[model samples]
Target: MPGRFFLTDPMAAVADALNVEVGVVGNEPARRNIAPGQEIVVFDGALSRMRWGIVPVGRVNARGRPVMEQIINARSETVFDKSAFEGVGRAVIPVNGWYEWTGEKRRKTAWRIAPKGGGFLYFAAITDVWTAPGGMNVPQVAAVTCAPNGDVAPIHHRMGVLLERDDLTVWMGDDLDAAKALMLPSPEGRLEISEAGDVDWDGV
Candidate 1:
């Protein structure tokens, strides 16, 4: 249930934290509701503008729209073998915090979860290149998800993969398998989450 999230800090701050030069996402507006299929900033020391969902080429609908099979989140266990993510579709997302919801099934309650001190977090993700409906090359990415660890488990069953500093190089390297291994749950004691100040699912 880890779906919506936020990136409150500027992309430059995130680059500083990752020890990489700030790339093209200069002074981007902080998104309080980051939905799929939109361009988002993701960098594993190489900040790039990546669309939110990964749509493999040649998999288009009857209308010629690229088919998106709910791939906004990839399972850590099967990310490598999944035919959809095997080639030219690996990436990482730099995020400060993400959102998860909990409440009665009929009435969803969205909560924002962030680090204790608002530090930067890099979420492991996969990317793909696709021709747009109008025949334009587009690159997109989705946050990798796994069984939550420590504190994030109680709020929801799934959590985005947050990478450690040392792992960034390998996570975004040439070896796909090596980067896939980094998709496992975040290291123990690496993250903390709390109830957001508000739980407004519909409000901005």
Candidate 2:
């Protein structure tokens, strides 16, 4: 699973790559350990922070967590049918790299996966808004995952879905069926992996 990631590309580069303009943000530096519930960058060429977990609408529990439960990664096979992720629309999570753990559960090793050319990966993600007490709404996101390809499977069973520039329109537009058709394991040789360095977000 792609549980953590780093988005070190400067806003300008991210905006240019995504072909969108930067919006408002509090000026946070890139994060090395992007864990659950922490705000991460989203594509729209904007810097909006979302709860890392995905909580579907109409499922908020009185206990605070969503009644439906949150998912860190949405499996590609069921994303379109699962009530949690379904035809819900799309977004991009721009990242320099994502980390996957290998080895036994007790002492797993972490590996960093990036695009073969060392450029940013425009990860495919889905988003929705959940209501809080007193009608407050919170936006949340989930990264879409698929079976790992040849280069990345050594570290994990699944990898995040990625979108090339050409596919962004299908993903971000109102065409759910078309976008779902594009959700498949990326072609072999599309990714490269290496041992992660000291967990430094800025160093990427």
Candidate 3:
């Protein structure tokens, strides 16, 4: 899974690659360590900034109790089946790569995972709007995850559902079945994973 994401690429280049407008989220500065709850660029039909975590404000469980925790990632297997995810919109999180950790907490090693040939990785995501008190609306998103591929299985048990450039439209399309079919592991050997050194964990 992508514990953290890094999008060092320029917004203009990302817009060109996705063939979409940059929209309100203009050419912002590069971010090396994008954590959950922070605003990240999201592409539904156009690019926009959205909080990386979904706050299930009024969502209730089977017993009609409030769901207190914010969701940063949703499993692909039950994303659609869950009542909590009802009315969620489809979107994509385009990033240069993501970081994963292995071993123990303090002694853990950070691994950077990216496209082998150096492009962008589009993570399938769900979008929602959380209404804060005093009538404030916050747009939010959460990445969808599936079983890890061969390259990721050794380091992590799950990985974000990545979509091909050609399949991005389908993933954001109105057809749920077509979009669900795109939620699968990226082809093995297409990603290059290595030690993530030189990253400042304390800085953005």
**Residue 84 miss distance in model 2 (angstroms):** 2.9
lDDT winner between 2 and 3, please give it. 3
TM per candidate comes to 0.84, 0.86, 0.97
- Give the root-mean-square deviation of each candidate in angstroms: 3.6, 3.9, 0.9
lDDT of 3: 0.92
| Candidate 3: tens digits of C-alpha lDDT, residues 1-204 | 777999998899899998978778776789999999899999999999999999888888778888868999999999998878989999999999999999997999999999998889999999999998999999999999999999999999999999999998899998999999998998898999999998998788
Residues forming the 10-long window of minimal summed lDDT in candidate 3:
20-29
The Cα error of candidate 3 at residue 10, in Å, is 0.7
By TM-score, the candidates rank as 3, 2, 1
* Cα-lDDT of candidate 2: 0.76
List runs of model 3 lying over 4 Å from the truth: none
lDDT of each: 0.73, 0.76, 0.92
lDDT of 2 at 115: 86
lDDT of 1 by residue, 1-204 (tens): 357767778777877887778767876887766777677888745777888877676655446666567468888887776556656556678777788778889876666677666687778887777778898888778788888887777778888888777788898888877876777667666555666665444643
Candidate with top TM-score is 3
lDDT of candidate model 1 versus the reference: 0.73
How far in Å is the alpha carbon of 124 misplaced in model 2? 1.1
- TM-score: which is higher, 2 or 3? 3
- Candidate 1: list runs displaced more than 4 Å: 57-70, 198-204
